[model samples]
Target chain A: MASIEITNARKSYGAVDVLHGIDLDIQDGEFIVLVGPSGCGKSTLLRMIAGLEEITSGDIAIGGNVVNDLDPKDRDIAMVFQSYALYPHMTVAQNMGYALTLRKTAREKVSAAIDNVAGILGLNALLQRRPKALSGGQRQRVAMGRAIVRQPQAFLFDEPLSNLDARLREQMRTEIRKLHRRLGATSVYVTHDQIEAMTMADRIVAMYDGIVQQVGTPLEIYDRPANIFVASFIGSPAMNFLSGTCQITAQGCALILDDGTSIPFLAPPNVSNGQKLTLGARPEHIDIVGNGSAPSVPATVDLIEPMGLSTLVHVTLAGKPVKIFTLARPDLAIDSTIEIAFNMDKTHIFDSETELRLPRANEPFAAETA
Target chain B: MSTPGKSRLRKTAYWGTHYLMIAAFVAFALFPLYWLLKVSVTPNDILYTEGVRMWPSRTTWDNYTFVLTQSHFPHYFMNSVIVSGFTALFTCIIAAVTGYAFSRFRFNGKIVIVALMLITQMFPLVMLIAPIFRILAPLGLTDSLTGLIIVYTAFNVPFATFLMQSFFDGIPKDLEEAAMIDGNTRFEAFRRIILPLTLPGIAATLGFVFTAAWSELLFALMLVSSESASTFPVGLLSFVSKFGVDFGQMMAAGVLALIPACAFFLLIQRYLVQGLTAGAVKG
Candidate 1:
């Protein structure tokens, strides 16, 4: 196992820059997921760590040694590509043992290593079959098997489970995490899927536009996103934002909306009165209550999506779209007015000009550390 | 298909017409080759008498024997094989590397290089015949099989490289990246992973260059003046004397000339049909 250290890693193509300066330290035996949207340079960062791509202006050290000048082979890392990229001509056993075979390991030793990995991946039945003969889920397992057999310094996954179906992707997501636990190998996985990052990583590194948005535990990032981009990008049904200006009057603090509507919330000390900012609330964090004891705002319910256990209710609050996740199957008609209250404790505030999350009163250091 | 309203009889008639048209085209293309085979077995005494007939009443092996033993056809055949074989070999090696570079790398002046290669194919070989002969004459390359090999390889490479490049483009870039991470160098990845996957493309390029060099007459006739270095196509013209044309001998030689090309295709047709890179990436 190895700890990867990347300092001021920058990637550019000619005059166009792809990755701005990025600094990250992946500890030994930690699963770090670099998650972002498309064109966000997550994969480029992973590729740079694997020595598949060169760092334009930075140092990347693997296992305490700088590998910026090394070839991918010399880097002693294994990668599972999103496409699987299994050699079509080689059988499952051969594919898994390819790295060891290249190292000129003994034939019996390579076979034993492949056998060990195949057993862990439930690929014993597929040992003699070629990649073309395997189904998509099977091929995904083989790709994973290919990486684990070598027991390299670390593993690099480039959206490795994206090609599978939903059920298979979920299953493999859990399986990969279990495998990582069993192996205790340092791994850097890159994916555009927020859920994958949330479920898989020991530390989630959320990135946007080639810059690291935040690096923290999954719940830390979820509870306190560093910026508006991180807040919106890390959640499903995404966090809803309301455009408003912070208003601190005698009767507690509230936000004055663009359309003359005001929603009440306790303002942080840093957000001064009449400062233009944005309010963020997750779908599950917004609730509908009858008594209206909490800071409540009247919203027009636009759409409702029932997802078996939970319901996603889309509402328009202060003339902005907002989603509320609730267990109660509220039989509400479209365009019906409903009183929704922000959880207040889970409510997030962002400066409109900076598009950065503003810290709450309870968490004084969230603004600096998030 | 049992799709909605489509009837079985209509589908049968549609497929029947499809096969009929295909059969018609096949016959149209193969009739000359059939005639070549038929004339090779026809005796010389009855060649003119049965000129219009598809098959002669009497058949003999005299034309085949005369062309194979009495004439200089064997010597010309060997020269054609050597030239075409070497040309195909050299062209494939050069095209594979160049095509791989074109497909995988983004280098300075790549577009200019590709445009220049394309431009090389724009002009007809006939226009450059004089210049090519002049360049080869002083270099002691003319009137030799080496001259024809070089000329054929040069003419065939650009198109062949384009062919190989398309095949390389079909393979996903991840395979090589994965191979590199699998402890293989970039060149080893190309050699071990990329090259094996490109067998079908190499087979196709080989067949193209071989047939092109085998049947090429313009450069072969112009570049070589000696009988020792003459190709089969040039030797085919020897049958055309000032008197009457030797139809039986020429047809017999033509039939023999197709054997290697046919045998070559037979050896490589498996690769052309295999589609080996099917599961190299996503299904």
Candidate 2:
């Protein structure tokens, strides 16, 4: 319903700084996900926006008004905690209507609001039951219903689905996405799970070490991560990195691995010969070419995992581990040498010292600006 | 081939010894109460003859009637009830608030305050009884039930606060944060959400303080000198004469003193059972 903006927000416990100055501008009715590993300050930022935590420095504005000094109730935001935090003493109906009752709304109006939210959440039959009588997934629905009944300026969810089992989590994930679309409310979801960010967000804000690593659409992040941290953290069967030196020969440009295996590719324009760099290749973008193929790096197969829909082949390339994902199951012996080729079009090259993705020679500066 | 039969015998022996040990401990704990009950019913004429007998060969209700109608014990019982009831009420209120602050906040000097409370509990009560009585004398509270209530509440608060703090710690802090985000202020959230969830803890503290004040003898003896303000423990001393101790009347009054404490526990027994916080969180 409203946009939330954060400018140079930083947090610290005495001298130990947790969040170094962060700046973000969220659009109205956008579903933004803050994703990272634990202790990355995503939850801290969300709490600061919700007015639960003080911003050690900087300001946060909700709906164009700065709420840095406001209390949580004054901020007009609702949060679904990871623990569900349903009031054990109150029944489902009372839990959902608590915010309205706190505002001293008319009884009929409060009930109507609760009824509408309950209908949307399918909680009619269980309205009379207390939190102890409901299952985990039901409690989660009640938590969501409580947030929706208030219809606050925005919604903040801090790992809301992490408490449920995998099957229920999967079901609720799609349900939450559908609910968000229907309501079209501005929501900021925080989770350490990358898949949740990828599938649920209009935009994903990837963070690491208390800094914003990248902010972009899911595919943009997957296709061209801004740096090595975002590159490795976003994908499943994570992108592999190989240390090599850039080389330019008569036939074409090639990367010479630390183990002396020559991997030929179309070098990006900015790289000079003998420049040290890290090559990143996603599993799905590596092919198991024929043994004597040209422009191929010979690898020794270490392990193969046969997933139902796709198989993952683990191989050692230039003394470094790399995983290859494919639809075809390869009947290859362990320790057997095989030649593999990188799809040069899908590959990423980063300056080793900076660990930043380098623009390819063909498209010069397209990926970096995104 | 015979493993099932052997294991069955093994389990039976293990359980049989476990039950035997527990039964022995239970009997050891209840023997004093059983003896008190038996002596209260024994007729005075046969009290000496029936010494050490499990069953008093003959029993009578004379001691019970005599203690109830003929002695000042009933007044003492009333005084004990008033003192204990007020002590429990005051201690619980103070403990609940202080415990909540200890559990939920990081304030200045919190560690030092907690350590001071612990330090108060370290000293022997006898050492402070003289100073307490001296302080109360000038205030004209030394020989009154109100004085007893104040002292008892002060003595019971530190322990009760610790007990309540443990209960509050078991509850998730998220519930109150969620309540605040739901539009209630922090104080309202404490009253409407956290306090209701702590009902079991409050009940436990009340029962604990009630029993402690009800049975306390040292302070009751040291503070009150008047028969009108005397509690049951001091009134029971009246039955002893210089010539000989009135065993029948004393035992009868002792038996009478236990009824309120027992009934008080019975009233709050359900809340004493843990698990009130279940389903408040993910569990």
Scoring each candidate complex against the real one, what DockQ results?
0.88, 0.83
Query: Which one wins on DockQ?
Result: 1
Summed over model 2, clashes come to 1
Model 1, C-alpha of A245: deviation from truth (Å): 1.3
RMSD of 1: 1.8
Clashing pairs in 2: A1-A186
In candidate 2, residue A95 scores what lDDT? 94
Report the C-alpha lDDT of model 1 over B76-138, residue by residue, as the tens digit: 999999999999999999999999999999999999999999999999888999999999999
TM-score on alpha carbons, each prediction: 0.97, 0.96
Candidate 2 lDDT by residue in tens digits, A68-148: 999999999999999999999889999999999989999999999999999998999999999999999999999999999
Worst lDDT window (10 residues) for model 2 chain A?
A361-370
Q: Cα deviation in Å at residue A57, candidate 2?
A: 1.5
